[model samples]
Target: MYERTARESMCKFCKYVIKIYGNQYLRKPNLNDIQQLYEVHESKHGFPEMLGSLYCMHWEWFNCPTAWRGQYLRGDHRHPTVALEVVASQDLWIWHVYFGVACSNNNLNVLEQSPLFNDIESGVAPDYSFEIDGVKYKYGYYLVDGIYH
Candidate 1:
């Protein structure tokens, strides 16, 4: 069927892309990256220790399995869909990406399921400290819309 063939082609293309550019484009930020990110975001937004902007997008899953349709259906759309959560800098450099979440869920739900703060919780995150209006802060923050909790 056309669906099966399309799925296979997409999978193959994704594999090839990941094989070629995965490490450079998809990995988490290191210490140096964190420092630069903080500096750039702080200078532009007046928010010290800021990382980037957070947003979520929905992708219609036209090939979603019938059995899982109910779980992925968005209230606004009749089609089954999946969600992708991304955090990117002003330069459009993606720092974090979490995908495959059901579109039925809200941005907050996707965020809760994402491993965005795993390193922070495990105490392995890079050390970030900055002063905002003479107040010292140790953790980095992200610019998120009102939808986020």
Candidate 2:
């Protein structure tokens, strides 16, 4: 939860920058607080719950393998050493996080036919939407490794 909370703060800070600067830095506030905002916004200016989920779910995060290694490795310094993007419901919990690597590296060919995919469901079938700040967001994640898209 600590990681999530810190991420929420960073996202919120980014969002604030975007609103005030008009995307000057291509900034976007993190939706970590989207749930809280969703609730408040709905009360003040209502929007459909489903829509809320969709909006909240449209976020991406970098899934770095180096970070997972528990040892700092100086990467190219200009690019993400390893990254992946995840899209799914919140907590949308990954049954096998390792599968993330296979997917991102395009190595799923060997893994997909395994029991991994069967055990790990993808997409929004289970629907794990949550409220942050007054907006409802669907939970999804993807790997991003660099500053430039």
Q: TM-score winner among the candidates?
A: 1
lDDT by residue (tens digit), candidate 2, 1-149: 69999999999998888789654433222344345544655665664332132211111234546554332122323323333333232333222222223222333443444333443355423343545464444433322352211
Cand. 1 Cα-lDDT: 0.79
Model 1 quality (TM-score):
0.72
- TM-scores for all candidates: the values are 0.72, 0.20
Per-model RMSD to reference: 5.9, 17.0
Please give the RMSD of candidate 1 to the true structure. 5.9
Please give the distance, in angstroms, between residue 112's alpha carbon in candidate 1 and its true position after superposition: 1.6
Alpha carbon lDDT at 149, candidate 2: 18
> Which segments of candidate 2 are over 4 A away from where they belong?
23-63, 66-149
Tell me the lDDT of model 2 at 114. Answer: 35
Q: Find the candidate with the highest lDDT and give its number.
A: 1
